[model samples]
Target: MPQMAPLYWLYLFIFFLLTLLLFFMVNYFIKPFDNISSVSHDTKIIYKSWKL
Candidate 1:
C-alpha cells in the first residue's frame, strides 16, 4: 500500500478553497459595477424622457 503525505492533501484543499474564494470575490465585486451602470443608464433615460 502506498501512503500519501497529509500535508499534500491540506495544500490541495487550501488551493481549492482559495480558488473558490477568489471566484466569489470577483463575482461580488462585479455585481456592484453592473448595478451602478444599469442604474446610471436608467437615470439617463428618465432624465431624457422628462426633458421631452
Candidate 2:
C-alpha cells in the first residue's frame, strides 16, 4: 500500500478542525433563532386562545 505524506496529514487535520468549528458555530447561531421562533409560535397560540 502507498503511504501518505506528513504534510497531507496536517492538511487533513486542519480541514477536519475547520469543519468541526463550522458545525459548532452553525449550531450556536441557530439555537437562538429556534428559541425566538418557538416563543413567537407560543405567543401566537396564546393570542388565538384569547380570541376564542
lDDT of 2 by residue, 1-52 (tens): 2366877889999999999999999988776666767867776644455665
TM-score for each prediction?
Answer: 0.53, 0.55
lDDT of each prediction vs. the true structure?
Answer: 0.79, 0.80
- Best candidate per lDDT, number? 2
Q: Name the weakest run of 10 consecutive residues (lDDT summed) in model 2.
A: 43-52
**Candidate 1 TM-score over all chains jointly:** 0.53
Q: Model 1, poorest ten-residue lDDT window?
A: 43-52
Writing each residue's lDDT as its tens digit, candidate 1 over 1-52 gives 2356677888999999999999999987776666767867876644455674
Predicted structure 1: lDDT:
0.79
Flag clash pairs in model 2.
none
RMSD of 1: 5.3
C-alpha positional error of residue 45 in candidate 1 after TM-score superposition, expressed in Å: 8.7
